[model samples]
Target chain A: MCTYETSHVAVEGAGKGADGWFPVTEATVYFDHPVAAMAEHTLNLDFLNRARGASARVAVELDATSAYALAQAILERLEAAPPALTGELHRR
Target chain B: MRAMDEAMRAETVKFAGHGGDEIEGYLGQPLGGGPYGAVVVIHHMPGYDRESKEHVRRLAAAGFLALCPNLHVREAPGASPDDAAAAARAAGGVPDDRLVGDVAGAIAHLTALPSASGKVGTIGYCSGGRQSFLAACSLPLDAAVDCYGAFVVEAPPPERGLRMTPLLERAGDLSCPLLGLFGADDQFPAPAETARLGAELTRLGKAHELHTYEGAGHAFFSVDRPAYRVEAAVDGWRRVLAFFGEHLG
Candidate 1:
């Protein structure tokens, strides 16, 4: 399982799906803010749902900061995963 | 100037497709030809606009009958920049399956051309690149080459599903040899994903090749884009010609 930890969140448990595709259940996200604060932000749940369904899933936990940082962190983690595959495949 | 002139002989031809609307494409052929193999060129996300037509012209100059179709007839043209942006916002997005159908239609159009050598192949860039890969996997084609395309290990969405990926899934039904080219710096589908795609192809025992240009980014072959790299694009064109010559011939 691939794991990445950021100041805003800790993401872990990455894996591929049965059909050899990247599954949506690969990440556990932790936020530094509380859930109440996150509720104040207008989250694009549709985008989140689509992302969750097709992309790596993150188990998000809110702390003290805003959801923006948590969302950015998740995006970074997802972006980071693809390069690992490239390195392995073209390892000259 | 000579090359540009040579590429300008392409003519727009309208043909009947599988029912809904009349299909039109830019058809290019060599000035002097003898039953050359046919090629269907798919455009990137910007759709089959000017650059795609130029691509068809270039392929024609290289002795292949190239066809490029406009895949966005269902949408209205954006009036101003903001209007266009708003139109894009309202349209949601073009579905991948419809893009695939456009490609299929282009292929069919090529096959029916009398001057074509029946042998047909495809090449695409960006989104078109993904479609080219899918065509190789799911359709009957002589060969395909993909540039900066996305490949998933898990099954993609039904519209985006080719079921052919990098490491995990095997490209069992791929009828022709495939070639994938990527830039090391492409953000969306990074170099590592391309590597996995190569690994999966290898595992399936399929004839394929993957080439990565070290410092290039996505859409490196697009002359109109800022990402264009002349050296990499030149090399890519050479490789594409060689690959098509080997397979489509």
Candidate 2:
């Protein structure tokens, strides 16, 4: 249905794109028609470094179930980490 | 049948877009000697990718000069189409004023073509469909086609990040015949919304025709996507070509 909804976030991390690894400064998330995915609409996420240009991006398109599973897994893994190993200072 | 035998040329072009900014575009035209009508192909929300370019070439094969402006070029110069689309979306989509200006420049470029017949039209799909209606309301197009363009008669929810308003109020300014193609099962511009638009245009005495294909949903014309409905797409194309032929000739 061409859902124009989008969510943007500023992040501090590195992602592997076409040109090896680059620090991603932001992320854009949306559920919309995919560029490569065969589905009519999918959960799309783009890790981008705007300073490096639009080409500096890592993208993924996943179905709703897969996206939800991935999100839960991320939260579970993060929460399972010990406080000493994943301290507040180390987060940055 | 002639389209099957037509010799055509398709290539990348550069032109002045909104605010005279140099932007990239795709140009496609038949190699026939005589003059031909022109069409401005507005890329859908997914951006100026393969399918959009294919639309331009198809029009050229149908014996019309066609051009599609890269609406995301400014946001991500030289970026891949998908990345550029992401950038544009993050920027809250293109401004309406900018879209009108870019289409104006495209018309200027088209009419200047030596083989142009001085008549021009526009056809847009998805978001471009709404933009096509917007452009027709603002520009002097000979004809306009809106294929499942939502937000024309109703506003999107506030969280959608689409910085656009409903364009129904501008119907009085529509300078050409309009052909609306819709899917009955679509929720965005539900059948009721299209009906309202039809009613408004009728009251205003504007020349128009609208058809909603039952059992078809949004993006039915998108062959690469699961929403594709061959029956609807084929019929829609036939109507589009006929409309363009009548008005642009």
Highest lDDT against the true fold, candidate: 2
B1-249 per-residue lDDT for model 2 (tens digits): 124577899999999998999998999978876478999999988899998999998889888889999999999998889899998887788889999999999999989998899999999999998999999999998999999999999998876657779999999999999999999999877999999999999999999999999989888888888889999999999998889888875
Chain A alone, model 2, TM-score?
A: 0.90
lDDT tens per residue, model 1, B38-58: 788876654556778888887
DockQ for all models, in order? Answer: 0.02, 0.67
Off by over 4 Å in 2: A89-92, B1-4, B159-161
Question: How does the DockQ of candidate 1 come out?
Answer: 0.02
Clashes of each: 21, 0
Candidate 2, which CAPRI tier? medium
